[model samples]
Target: MTDRSFLDWPFFEAKHRAWADEVEAWAAAHAARLTDEHDADGSTRALAAAMGEAGLLRAACPADGKLDVRMLCLARDILARHSGLADFAFAMQGLGTGAITLFGCEPARDFLADVRAGRALAAFALSEPEAGSDVAALATTATRDGADWVLNGEKTWISNGGIAGGYVVFARSGEAPGAKGLTAFWVPGGLVRVVERIEVSAPHPLARLAFDDVRIPDSHRIGAAGDGFKVAMATLDVFRATVGAAALGFARRGLDLTVERATSRKLFGAPLFDQQMTQGAIADSAVEVDASALLVYRAAWLKDQGTPRVSREASMAKLHATEAAFRIADRCAQLHGGLGVVRDAAPEVLTREVRALRVYEGASEIQRIVIARAETAR
Candidate 1:
């Protein structure tokens, strides 16, 4: 169980605390039974269905059915603390349907209902081979073809790429050069087709999508024709904080496991926890974990309080939490000696998982840039 003390901070309200307890209970009960080793596609689908059955998907979006940053962060933190696969399952459910939740035409609303019901999986397809953090460098283009839009080019490093039922695709809309030319689309995955599913170090679902004149109705556009950048930015602003929350969860798990193991493992006629070195390590981890929690919830609370564009807060949270999670995981591995590197110990899995978080959702370096840009702009 998480330390309830974080709830006492000004960043969280009673409702957030209540939601945390509820999700924590659900996670404790169900996280262990769900394994993600083999049949990744099937496991992800099952995970989503289980999340839906638990009614956690309800919190993935807001009361108005829009994306709620606070709820997303809470769910990710809770689930990621319990299981990385669980967090991944929950995160994709929001990100995949985020565009529709924010801005979709008539048919998009019906599509969102499927997401809430777990009848379908959702994906966000914005990254490409040429574009990782540089959004302005994207080469994918979508043009109007009578009543439909014809899409061309490819999106790589896409989450839930092959498995999701639908995707919020971004492409150049011919408005102007750079970000302004981009537009977002709610394209059904079956309609777009996947080029290949790319395996990563962490073994989560990711793929490359090639749109070869993929025909989508004009009604599929999210926001205006040239507002893809705005839509994508707005969507990221909410979920980015949640990414940090997920990192916080990972760090918390690392701390818990390390503390438990240190107390139990004996060395040189005494428990590892008895050593000053071990105590220092644990203290450092605990402090960092709390710091991560503060940054994460601070961003969440700011958003809940109706602050616009938490780019700096989100960047700070994501950067700190992700970097700290890696450190915590590394320290856990070190504390375990050779056992930590073993697959059975889970640190090995966590090591890979934490590494991925540092890169995705904007890399640690990119986040630094974002924070600096925001600070300087102000």
Candidate 2:
């Protein structure tokens, strides 16, 4: 129903196209089971398991351990089109375990298998109450003990916080200030306590975590003590574009619902689509969707081509696509008139989901700064 012609773009290979088709089919079959209004956490866990069973998670981590950004984008795009919760489950799995996949020791590999199989939930704990886009401002600390590391700080807004089997926590561990002092640890959920469960407009298993001297074995260290910042940035570089793809999916779905409504609903004794104003809105939605796809796929393609770091491209894609999707969702809601504002309506739900995308990963303001920095450096 959404635009499949984008698959023909040179950005994707034959295998990527095949994988996209397969994922879309799987999502179609499992759409109902992927979302549950009564139990958000349970549904997320179930969706992760289903994705693992369907072998869709293989794209999250290939045999060679190299992350394929294009495949990741494809999966997110398709899954998001079907269910936002499903996309959340899949993205968190990839993100939570990404540090281990890219930099973990042999022991961390064992945890990743559980993650891929959906037997264990994973989370990324980098942001704190005080530190968000400004990673240098993180206050979490990891102090060395005799043979272990003690984490003592709080992480808020963590996805899969209460349910994750383990977390890739970033903390200050050295004398240097800012990001240079940070370290990454793979801490089991048992070591930390869920201080509070965060409820958002678009529900997911988010929580605030408290680490009261949580002890973890030194083996759980992801990289060198000073490598946490690098690890986090690298992981984000790979996933940021996929966020845009997810936004694109939401925008595309909103557009489709709008088209269906306009064509079927009539006003003033004619179809709603008959109005020039309606036509203008539809045209704007189409352009925004296509433009978002172009930016998203471009970033994915460049990452796949072995660009060591794609901060500029990734930020551009995320900023443009997320902003565009929010606007498109708002426009769709406006077009739907009274029905759009009703609870659980397609446009209303999409508006909430798309709004969060603009804030997470890196906010639009941060992305603009990143882009500006890169341009000035050039």
The candidate that wins on lDDT is: 2
lDDT of each: 0.85, 0.90
Q: Write the per-residue lDDT of candidate 1 for residues 267-311, one digit (tens) a residue.
A: 999999999999999999999999998899889888878897898
TM-score of 2: 0.98
Candidate 2: 10-residue stretch with minimal lDDT: 55-64
The lDDT, on a scale of 0 to 1, for candidate 2 is: 0.90
lDDT (Cα) of model 1: 0.85
Q: How many clashes (backbone atoms < 3 Å, residues ≥3 apart in a chain or on different chains) does model 1 have?
A: 0
**Candidate 1 clashes between residue pairs 3 or more apart in a chain or in different chains:** none
Residue-pair clashes per prediction, in order, are: 0, 0
Q: Residue 198 lDDT in model 2?
A: 94
RMSD of each: 1.3, 1.0
| Candidate 2 residue lDDT tens string, 1-378 | 687999999998999999988998899999666698557899999998998888888777555688899999989888888899999999998999888888865667777888888888899999999999999999999999999989899999999999999899999998588888899999887888999999999888999999998988889999888888999999999999999999988888989988998899999999999999999989999999999999999999999898888999999999999999898898889989998899988888888888999999999999999999999999
